[model samples]
Target: MKRLSVEICVCTKCVMNGAMDIIEAVEGLKKLKTQLRLNSQVDIVTRSFCSGADVCPLVCVNGERMEHSNSETVMAKIISLTSKDVK
Candidate 1:
C-alpha cells in the first residue's frame, strides 16, 4: 500500500471559500483507502508561511499540487495517486 501525505491551510479566506469542507473531503478519502488498499494518511495542517495563500485553499497529494479544487476533485486526486495500476 502506498502512503499519501496531504497538506492544507486554515486561513480565513480559505475558510470563506469552503476550505474547512476540504478537511471533510480529506477524511472522505478513507473510503478510497479501503478500495485502493492504500494507506491514506492525511495531514490536515495550517501553514502560516504557505505562499499558496494566493491560491488559498490548496490541496496537495504526495507533493503534487491540485488547484481550484472542490471536494470531488480532491477525492479524484487521491484515487489517482493510490490506485496501483492507473496509467
Candidate 2:
C-alpha cells in the first residue's frame, strides 16, 4: 500500500501552540480507520522539530506542508487522501 507519511512538529514552540492535540486527533482517526476496515493505505506518523520554525505547529502530509496546523485541518487533509491510492 502507498503510505501517507505525516510528520508533525513537536518542538517547544509547536507544543506550546497545541501540537499534541493534533497528534491525538490523528491517532483517534487512525483507530476509526482500523474499525472501519479502511486498511488499503497506511499512515506513518512522526514527530520532530519544526523545519519551518516561523510556522510553528506545522504538519506535512505526503510531503505537502502546512503551517499553523490544527487538529481539524490536519484531519481533513489526511482523510482526503483516498484509499484507492493503496499499492
Candidate 3:
C-alpha cells in the first residue's frame, strides 16, 4: 500500500480555531480507510507550530501545504491523492 503523510498544526491559535475538530475528523478518516479499501495508508502527525499562523488551521498532505483547511477539504485531498494511484 502507498503511504500518505498528513500534518496538522496544533499551535495555540490553531487549537483555538478548531484544530481538535480537524484532528478528530482526520483520525476518523484513517480508521475508515480500510473499509473504504483505498490503496493508501495515512500517517497523521501533529506539529507544534506552523508558519501560517495567520491562517490558523493549517494542514499538509504529502508535504503540500494547505491553509484555512478544514476536515472536509483535508479528507477530500486525501481521497483524491489515493484515488490517483488506485488500479
Candidate 4:
C-alpha cells in the first residue's frame, strides 16, 4: 500500500486560522479509509510552524506545499492523490 504524508502547520497563527479544522477532517478521513475505498495510508503530522507563516494555515501533501489551506481543500487533495492508485 502507498503511504501519503500530510503535514499541517499548527502555530498559533495557523491554529487561529483553521489548522485545527483541517486536522480534524484528516483524522475523520483516516477513520473512513475502508469506506472510502482508499488504497493508500495517510500519515498526518502537525508541525509547530512553517516558513509560509504569512499564509497562516499551511498544509503539505507528500511535500507539496498548499498555502492558505482549508479543510475542504486539504481533504480533497488527499482523496484525489490516493484515488490515482485505486485501480
Backbone clashes in each candidate structure, one number apiece?
Answer: 1, 1, 0, 0
Give per-residue CA lDDT, model 1, range 21-67, as digits (tens): 87887786675656666554655554433454577667676677766
Model 1 lDDT vs. the true structure?
A: 0.65
> Predictions ranked by lDDT, top down?
4, 3, 2, 1
Q: Give the best candidate by lDDT.
A: 4
Top TM-score: which candidate number?
4
Candidate 1 residue-wise lDDT at 2 = 41
Q: Which whole-number lDDT from 0 to 100 does residue 3 have in model 4?
A: 97
For model 2, the local distance difference test gives 0.76
Predicted structure 1, TM vs. truth:
0.72
What tens-digit string does per-residue lDDT give for candidate 3 at 1-87?
Answer: 789999999998889888889889878987887776678888889987576459879889999988888888988998889888874
How big is the positional error of residue 51 in model 2, measured in Å on the Cα after superposition?
Answer: 4.4
User: CA lDDT of each candidate?
Assistant: 0.65, 0.76, 0.85, 0.90
lDDT of 2 by residue, 1-87 (tens): 556778888888888888889889888887787554454354656677576468988888888998999999988887777444432
Ranking by TM-score: 4, 3, 2, 1
What does candidate 4 score on TM? 0.92
lDDT of 4: 0.90
TM-score of each: 0.72, 0.78, 0.89, 0.92
lDDT of 3 at 81: 90
